[model samples]
Target: MASPTTAPARDASREALTDSPPVDGARAPGRRARMPLRGHLRELRTRSLWVAVGLAVGALLGWALYDPLLALLTRPLHLAASTEHRDIALNFTALGAPLDIRLKVSLFLAVLVTCPWWLYQVWAFITPGLTARERRYAVGFLGAAVPLFLGGGALAWWVLPHAVNILASFAPEGTSQLVNAQDYLTFVMRLVLAFGVAFVAPVLLVALNLAGVVRHEPLARGWRWAVLAAFVFAAVMTPTPDALTMVLVAAPICALYFAALGVAVWHDRQVDVRV
Candidate 1:
């Protein structure tokens, strides 16, 4: 025969036990559940392994296609030599230069070929932290970034002949230019990467706006400076004396900037409405 007070206390204790979640499922009070450091490390390792495998496979493909790729890259140089009426030679000066070039180019191709996969791995790693809206924005940006980068690279390749012709035309009369294969390839890679990164800049700006790190008004106000900067960048990159080539390179960049600005403005309006 338990006392009335003891019975009430027993009932309360049983109710509490029944209402509480199991230990394995329970989260800390007043906080979102988080993965442990070890779990994060494991996840990172797994993704890194996958990325490495992808690069390896891409490298094999690049190795197989090395000759065709090399020919494609040097076609511009040959075109420039022909157009400028200059005798230009690409020579491997060092004993192991050919092997080195092959390896480097293969690695570069691997990176380019496996870009989408690695990018997705990166996205997957960071996605758990993002809200639904942020994930959508990230996906959109990532999709745009790859195509824009590739387009920029293509644009650089298209302009390469003109740039080579202009630069080679500066050589003194009766001097046959002997260019190192390694140095020329390095120059080509740098130009391609620079153009790719530049094209991706607008996407970054739009992303910042969407993420609330920047506002649309400031970007809109700086259109004049942006246009000037674009032309200057184009001039530097193209290395052509004529304004036409510079305009061709700058026009696309200007268009992308304005497009990004428009997106920012639309996003801001949507945010305001929500607010």
Candidate 2:
């Protein structure tokens, strides 16, 4: 019923209404402007708060499980005592040492238990800058890293008793070991943490290769150094007098490094093909 000119004007008005800029001032429907520094700080603050909350809750759980955890950690000392036929005591010189060690162990357990959550938070914070392919790589990195680290920690536990036995054997015919509780705890933690971190180091190499930060050829060429480093690391971490225990620890690390190297070579080839 309207005139042609009036119909055209109506269409124009509708088009204007539909195509007008958003009230929020977004340039396009699905696009957003870069967040300001304050926004990023706020986001970081929120994520950090959640991480702290997770740690606190995990620490509570660790406290509840402290008895079993302590028992497990001290098993190496017990084994050493039995095998060496000597008195091995973990002495606490300070009155507050017990409470301090408990708190420290609980915190360590909390960090281990809540690692996946905190790692995801870290990944999430950096994800905006990554492409989809990079995101997939990140996910795979997390999945592989966590298990490898845990496995390495388990291996360290298995190796502990032998290392303890060997070291304890070095004592004179009648001397008993009076180890400080804090010192022993620190040693155990460092050994376990070192093994875990060492296992994860290969995964980092793969990540670097994926990011094109390092080439596979260099890794291949450095095989001898890798072997040497693996032995040196085993020597430092395990402190065994014989080659057998050191080899047992070093073998897995060497295998993992070569495995990671293979992965890098394969990935580099694929990238070459794609290019």
Candidate 3:
């Protein structure tokens, strides 16, 4: 019933219809690639499985090195007690406490040992969505983050002895400074982990800068806020409530924040030049 003059238009419409994808099975052209909820859940499971494997391997390593690591952790206690001519050491009030401590230590050590691997697994999962340039920045971020974390842990380790000495010096004359094993270990681990995470946070800020999500001007103008945050983090995280120890904790982080700011500024300049 179509007019003869519209025959070419009808033919072209039919051809286009034939070339078009099926509505039930295909996404529209120019739509961004997005995974369904089911796909996201599957990806999460896969990443979790690999992370568990890394933790298991790290646990084994922790078990193998338990004795030496225990000694290393107890060094500050030894130094403090020995200086006071006392043999006061970590004590447990319950029967199964030793086993509990071992399990705790193993778990914590596993987290520390497998951190980079687990982080890489996380990155690998998210990388498919990122551009090549974004991937490069992410890898650079991971690299910078790992070393800074280790360095922060090292700083915590160094600070612990001084902090211990300061606390012990406050003990009343002729009394031993007894400590609960579980509490001491928990405190020590939290301090190290806190410092480690704090150091890593600045890397995220720098990464954002590199991604053009944040500018150097705001970051530079917010130095006071950063310093305040550093002090608050230190006050909350450090085991003891000493001003000196808090200062020690905050000082390095503030310095690192400035360093990160400098790097981000330079990187923004480079990006501007490129643009």
Candidate 4:
């Protein structure tokens, strides 16, 4: 009874409905396919732009504060020189050595200042691939890392003058000992880096335990070997062979290991409760 025109419209509507896909059993296209390499590259470029900005800012700050930074870094030498009536002079074999050292120091300061930004960029890039639990762990470790590194650096700053004194004691009287600025800076940098890394050992161990990669009992059993290894690391990394420096480095590592063990034990207990 419908008109011919109405019948055609109805037919067209039915055809369209039939041709359209059903939602229940249909699968959406993957994110990877929907956004291809070009899109990914564009995102990466944006992130990199931000990182570059941060580095540039850090470099500017470093350049502005170069004199103060140099003074702070040379404090140990200054203290030693004052005590021993000696001078710490920076010798330059090359014509550009002094300028090069300044530029290098500026770069180092910039990198140090920009570390958090750089770390965040790296974390942001990788975070999309991590699960919720992994993200939690990453955040936890990062929160712990700042304090641990600061503690280590503070310890180094406190002990370094004494260590310098011990080393200067070996020089003969009236010789007018001179320590090269470049060499002194390198030594201080190495010591600070070594201690900072050592202090974070516990956080790493606890993370491994939480990931189920290592267990409490094995770590507890490995204590003897761990202590020995700590001593070896101290001996190798300490700038001086002085017993005080060696013990100062080793003691913290031992403490960190035990702290890690305690964390592992607690984690194991929680696992037992869950089971």
Task: Tell me, by TM-score, which candidate is best.
Answer: 1
Score each candidate by Cα lDDT.
0.88, 0.87, 0.83, 0.78
For all predicted structures, in order, the TM-scores are: 0.86, 0.84, 0.75, 0.77
If the candidates were sorted by their TM-score against the true structure, best first, what order would they fall in? Answer: 1, 2, 4, 3
Report the CA-based lDDT of candidate 3 relative to the real structure: 0.83
Error of 1 at 203 (Å): 0.8
Residue range 1-275, candidate 3, lDDT tens digits: 87887989988999898667545324333222367778878888999999999999988888888889889888999998877666568888799998888888888899988888899889977876666566677788888889999999998888888767666767777787668999999889887987888899889898788768998989999999999999998776655656888888899899999998998889889988999
Each prediction's number of clashing residue pairs: 0, 0, 0, 0
What is the per-residue lDDT of model 4 for residues 34-98, given as tens digits with 9 covering 90 to 100?
56679778767878988888888888788788899888877876788788787655566568877
Write model 1 residue lDDT over 166-228, tens digit each, in one string. 888899877788889999999899989999998999999998997799999999999999999
lDDT of 1 at 14: 94
Instruction: Superpose all Cα atoms of candidate 3 onto the true structure and report the RMSD in Å to 1 decimal.
Output: 6.9
Ten-residue region with minimum lDDT total, candidate 3: 24-33
Better candidate by lDDT, 2 or 3: 2
Q: Cα RMSD (Å) per model? A: 5.5, 5.6, 6.9, 7.0
